[model samples]
Target chain A: MVTAALKEDLPGAGREISIEAVSHRFDLEGAPLPVLDDVSFTIEPGSFVALLGPSGCGKSTLLRLIAGLDHPASGAIRVDGAQVGAPDPSRILVFQDPTLFPWRTVRANVALGLEAQGTLKTEGHRIDAAINLVGLQGFDKAYPHQLSGGMAQRVALARALVNQPNVLLLDEPLGKLDSLTRLAMQTELVRLWQQSGLTAVLVTHDVEEALYLAQRVIVFGPRPAQVVADLTVDLPYPRHRGHPRIAELRHEALRHLGLEASW
Target chain B: MASIELPLEAGRAPAPVQGWTLLAALPWFAAVAVLLLVPDLTYQPLGRELALIWGAVGGVLTLLGLFGNRLGRVGRWSALRGPWLFAIGAASVLWTVVTAKTGWLPQPFFPTPQAMLEVFLYDYGKILHSAAFSIWLLAKGFFFGAIAGFLIGVGMGWSRAVSYWATPLLRYIGPLPATAWLPLAFFIFPSSGSASVFLIAFSTAFPVAVLTWSGIAAVNRDYYEIARTLGASPLFLIVKVAIPSALPHVFVGLFMGLSTSFAVLVVAEMLGVEAGLGWYLQWAQGWAAYANMYAALFVMAAMCSGLITLLFRIRDRVLVWQKGVVRW
Candidate 1:
């Protein structure tokens, strides 16, 4: 039984991700504005990694690329040796804004991916499990407008979880929540990542958040983003907030982000 | 006593009795007295019937004022609402004195209350037929126009090629009123009824198409991105994402289209229909049967208002999620 539990905790559920020399740009008033600067990184299967960066550093853009919502201008992104051509149910992105369909109830919003995959009939119970996982059991019938900001984000996360995706690409998913909610959600994120056994890539500007949750925090520089530092948090899950290692890593991340770390 | 005095206060009490309820019956009694005492200057056929109606209203109001507190909140509210009933009674008495009791306002132009009543009683069948015919024509044209507009709007919204083709044509033709299409429409269609339908549909289709287009265009790009990353197909994006997001705008379009259809329907009916409220109005005017025209106009107003209310009811039900967020 102990062996079986250990096996379940292994990386069997998550797929490996590789980004080889990926670059992307946006057309701003007819001028090509580079966002991702030939950035390349590999994420190990079932690892919780945070893409820590200042705002507009293209970390969110990278998350989108990994989700296969947008194609990189150059280079390739592969999941377990297969290059992703388009969005697949195996990968999902939860945006900063919950972006819940305002017309849909919480349950209906969570059911979106299953509905898209035509698997709702068989896997319908996943919607309930997802809602419960996010601690939004009683709000299943509530509309997006009725929800508080943190609850709406929870619904968004639940929406991503319902798909049972191998990789969860969260693009600053807790960026809009209040500081207290953000801190609470940071712990929730770690618990969820451990429970699901999926590869989690969180893009966040909050250095402390990265340190608190991710097993590895990959710090990024300003626009046309390139990797500046990748500090692995060697601590285990249920990390102490007052850990000295977290303070050191946060200072290191802040220095790379060009911010004066007062703390 | 304080509870009765401050009955209208929020959450004070569900049922509140007002002493003014009994006073509401007074004006109706006054109108009835005037109907009996006043001398008729013209031959008003339904004066007795009018008096009976007034007497009945007064009797009902008196009964409601006396015992409506026992019927709970809705009843108590109605019983307390007596000023409007008084106003109606006062207006009737004044109208009788001016038109039937005296020759202050000339006949055929300003008919008496009894003359209006005569038209209602005697010409009920013909008016009902015209009203029914108008409704059928309105429904057909509105349904077809709404469906066509919705399709065009969705097509234009989702496809670059369709938008490219439709935009120029819409700009050129959409601004022109349906009356401008009248002569051409009649010339093309075999029957004037079909021609009228075309006009109503044409008027309705424009607003619905434009609003639907704007609605779809205004959708947040983040919504599309969210759906896409969740494994939605291109078709699923349009139908599930684009359509539902655009429904509020579509309803706005439908409402605008519906009102415009009423105007076009009247114009279309006046131009060629054998029977309709509009045709009946024109016919009554031609024959100097002013009373019939008045009755027709009243029916037309009631029908239009009723249809609008029905649309609002449907909108409320369908867009229940938008209750506090968007107010039409």
Candidate 2:
């Protein structure tokens, strides 16, 4: 399995990323609607964190800011130690949709990140191995159209994994899946994280999903969003859904999120 | 919720192989058998020609049928995807055969299909040279015109300022068909072939430009945003993303432009060009050599069919995503 250390190490030695007073705004009512006001956070090296929030909160926007897919209206965003300006291959972002290029088959799509890096011909077998790691071995030649929603998303995950990003950012990556597939993908993602050592930060409205996957969950309140709560998951690897502590923590997280209990 | 592995070989289903040559030879065997058994069926001029043409047609159909494993390989067969050249070839032969039997159509008096085939085989060196000239004219007209139009269209589409300034002016000129430019071209151009080339270029450029512009306009906003987010250079976006994404639409323009250029060349050739399929067609018609006229018509049909077939094949191979097919 490839590791993120292969990327150029960000200077200032220890810091993985830092967001300093970053804020985002949009024009609403012909005036500024502060979606994220003075939002400040820091992600430590090799951390598995989740940004949790209710709908319409700027959780996804925060993730995008760190990935440099969007600029903060104010203040600085840094990856490692340097300021964020644009998306770098070293910080891969996976969206809710698979976003696999439809013209390419699954293997080709999975290999594309490496292909873009001009390393595929020298490391093509590595791509195959990554796909195999994601349990998508048989789907190597299948077109995106031919795969199920779950399978296609797995290919997207494989594509991201193949890049060996220092920071793996996901924007509700499992929100579009059926319940069973979402559960399966969450497990697969955790497994991938342990094996590949990706510093993952996922943003989602699903409190349970956030709690289930992350080492630490950070919940943000509605617009002008800021971290309202942070909780550590002390459960071991392959945590069971039926565990009493898991349920209690999930309910507690949801309650703080102001969402009615659905489970 | 454990990650699961699927069997690597589960999805593949092997395709059946077929023998097309054997299938084509079946009709030949049948025709030979009929000729041997019935002398009455074998001893006529029209019968000989029908047998020859039928052998060719049957050969093609048998090839398709025998290679049934490959015939309907994938995708739907709508009008846009039909085998137009094959239809044209079959139509040409059918017209010849029907005209021969009924004498209903104004007739050609020169040598028949058998004669042309023999001429094609023995005097091919000379025929090939003439074919080369005709091909050159076709190429010159198509390439220069299509390229000019594509570039102009891409420019117009990419730049709103250019489109705003140039659209009305071009629209005014585009309606005037290339052939209509022939009279003006006659006085201005130094030679007949050059004039034909200019006419074809002007004719083809308009649609190419129009198609290119529309193709540019059709680019999704998301793609641009994606490129920008990736920090792609302006050159990279235009060369890599914009051009490829616009290709399907540009090809439509090119195919139509090519067909139009060829058609226009026929009328253009009649002006003063001494050689070409169109020139030969007129030569035969002037002498009332209806058989030669028919033969030339057959050749022209073959050329057009060949061109369209070639373009479709190239398009299919290159634009695998587009999945264009030849129907009928």
Candidate 3:
């Protein structure tokens, strides 16, 4: 029930998102190929949710719809009772590839959102703060090519964070990182979400990652994806990898994804 | 009260004197010797004067080879080996030609290098004036063409409608050589100078526009999407994302345009211009002043290379982030 003014003024001022019967399709050689089919979900303000599904299940597409980067073929996605039409700085989407502008330094890339909004002169300090928050200190002048995969992703995170968005849509943000960096970044992501107190919807195929970070997991079906299962983790902070309860939840999530509990 | 004494080594290894330095100096020494010992077989030449100048050049090279290590940091004397060889070869060939020993290539057509050098010394003022005028014309044409081409290219890239209309026209008109329009250009413009300028500009514009269009078009869609999500306006996306991303391609276009402009400049100047390197070349050719023509050619080569090097320097500064990613 947060008002638009309140959301605009405050950092991490969460906005309740209610997506009703949203569907999306892509045109492939003059053919309408269904991607998302009648997907309905509600994300509470300041909550962490994970959209878990198999590859090609339209999880990322759903996030795109909510971010207003694309319009749903049918139904509507609303943030705080207002229908989403176009992309806004209030909802930032971080993609799998860092997608950082190669010509700009890390500092300049992080300042993009502010610069676009013409608020860089006033809120310039936030760029440095966001870089610091992402643990990318002392890399202000580093170019994208100079960075490691994890560091580049951290810069991408900082770029999104500098806007102080109410919702952060993550599409496999750490998918390209190595196992060790992935494990570390998972913890970092959780800490960032907790500190910011903003609604987060992460689209991941990793069952363990979903269980480790998100409070709610929305499993999606194959192709014309619809909600298969909606489960709550209800786990405590700093959740152990080998915890019996987490292991059981992992099995459940895998079952919903139509995969054997291989792990 | 007492000075501490350090033990001295019984044997010390001698610092290696670079042998390549001596190898580089041998050719220059030979060149100087040839110039001095060999008498000119031609009637109109002074071999002694040529020998003195070459002897000075050879002496300098020998000095560089001998004391190059003392130059500190700039002590890479081995790098000069190739240039040293080239100079020797060129000098020997020129000595043979001017000496008329072979009688294979006669004068008026193939003048001696010294004769060309004499032209440089005698007519330097005229050469300088022509060079200055050519540079001014080149600058005006290049800037105007580059600016116009960039604008048109950006528009074509940003809008489908603009691309739809302009793309076909560009394809049709872009490939035609700038020289082909000479007859029409002469009549359309008020003066030949302006027409020449227009021709230079026209030659430069096509490649720049075409490359820019492609550069902008080739930019990844993900960038536009990301920029849009971050609240970038259409203008912001075009300026910040599209332009910066397409800069590498724009530079490619600029390089192409620059080279073509030079070609067009020479042709344009030759046609009707009163002063320029190309004009000087035409005038020299008309009067059978082959030495002056060769001198002007040398000037044109140096100027073109200097300008290209300047462009590369600008590219390096502006595209600093693309350091190791893209190399010349």
Model 3 steric clash pairs: none
lDDT of 1 by residue, B34-142 (tens): 8888888866787788889989988887877777777677555756467776777778888888888886988759888888989999899999999999999999899
- Give candidate 2 regions above 4 Å deviation: A1-15, A27-33, A115-126, A138-140, A261-263, B1-132, B149-176, B186-190, B216-234, B322-328
TM-score of chain B of 2: 0.68
The DockQ of predicted model 2 stands at 0.15
Model 1 chain B: ten consecutive residues of lowest lDDT: B10-19
Whole-model Cα lDDT per candidate? 0.86, 0.71, 0.85
List, for all models, the DockQ compared with the true complex. 0.83, 0.15, 0.80
Native interface contacts retained, candidate 2: 0.11
Better of 1 and 3 by DockQ: 1
Q: Which whole-number lDDT from 0 to 100 does residue B296 have in model 2? A: 63
Ranking by lDDT: 1, 3, 2
Candidate 2, residues B68-101: lDDT per residue as tens digits? 4455542112112234434544454544444443
Off by over 4 Å in 3: A1-10, A260-263, B1-33, B45-47, B73-79, B82-90, B97-102
Error of 3 at A96 (Å): 0.9
Winner by TM-score:
1
B237: Cα error in model 3, Å: 0.7
lDDT of 1: 0.86
Against the correct fold, how does model 2 do in TM-score?
0.74
